[model samples]
Target: MNLQVLQQLGMSERDITLYLALFQLGPSSIRDIASHTGINRGTTYEALKQMAARGLISYAPKGKRRFFRAEEPDKLLELAEEKRASLEQTIDSLKTEIIPGLHHLKPEFSSGNVRFYEGDDGIEFVLKDILATVGKLEEKTYSVFSTKSIRHHLYRPFPNYTAQRIKQKINVRVIALGEGGEDAEYSERKWLKTDGQVDASYIAIYPPKVAMISMASENYPVATVIESPDIARAQQVVFEALWRFL
Candidate 1:
């Protein structure tokens, strides 16, 4: 079957082949297993040693020969569960030790400092930051969107993200070109038409900063975020005027 899945489940390719070979041939020596799997003799020996260590295989010494055989496949589940438990314990210890230390290692920058976020993860981070920060500052947010970059991203669950944003009771005002109406599924509190002025523009104006995002090709989504009080106030006035009329 799929070797990657077996690898992810903690089996090396050689171990996987050796286990399957053992299952097929009952009990066999290293040379027979190597011939069956096409793995070199040294590699087959190593795989057998590892499998034996993990309790997936056992060897019985008869006279001068050692025969290797597979243990019950049900032991794989037990081994996997043991690993999970060990991982959980390690995670708990790290959380207790590391998370408290994070407070001491504070960032060198101040809050409301302009941060440029690019691409899908960057976009998601900015949106989540807005929801957390602006949700307390402004009751509403206005959005001007283009469909170019967003149409191709497979990053997050889109509808779920929109639903969560709306659930926060943060109002959204939208100014869009013709195609924008069809793409943005989040219902706008206010909708304005752009009259086809710009090419592939995405803009969001928050209290502290104004961000413009555009994707030239499918790959890089560039965002320019500015944190100037003068510029933000000017943009706010412009948005209010557009909101009042449209």
Candidate 2:
């Protein structure tokens, strides 16, 4: 049987070996158990002590010597249940005490900041963050400079992002830098010159934030989120001017 599962349940390898050895050898002495499991005597003795403390093993004194034997296999299941209960209690304590303490430790800043995210998962995080932060009001809208290359990277992983936005009734205005993304409900799209003039970068303006996503590199997808209201407003102004011209 695979004893790695026991290790995952928090029993050490030496403890597992010693326990199994005891189970097979039926109340053997420490030296015999160590020899049977190919573990050193000192380490075997220490593991037996710890396992006995956990009720996985027991010892009996016979004259001047001691013999160790494994408890019934049912005890292993009981130990596992106890561990699970202890872990649930620890999680509750962390949620109530540690997490709130850490949240209060975060410093507040006045000026806006920039955060960078990389890889496909990181890009998904950015998209989810946007969805969570933006309000659900009908008048709320965001603008984007969408490009085919970035969309190719994004849509494969997050196929339902636009659908989710539409479901949430969030409106978007998009300026396409190249060809081929359809305009869905609750969105407006305008195209720019598509004759290989634009690179594979996307910019989004959502009031207090401007996100620049780049998919041009061979390494990984990258995104930079700037949380400056002044910069976002400037980008929105430029986008509106170009929108009118187009």
lDDT of 1: 0.70
Strongest candidate by TM-score: 2
Clashing pairs in 2: none
lDDT of 2 by residue, 1-246 (tens): 898799866798777778788878999898899899899989888888988898889999988889998888998899788889999999999999999998677555333367888888878888876776675434668899988776778755577899888888888899998787886999999988776757678887887788888874764788999887789889999999999999
Each model's lDDT comes to: 0.70, 0.83
lDDT of 1 by residue, 68-177 (tens): 99999898788778888999998997788777677457553446356776777776766675566557774566544444335344224233556666687666666554
TM-score of 1: 0.60
lDDT for residue 33 in candidate 1, whole number 0-100: 91
Clashes of each: 0, 0
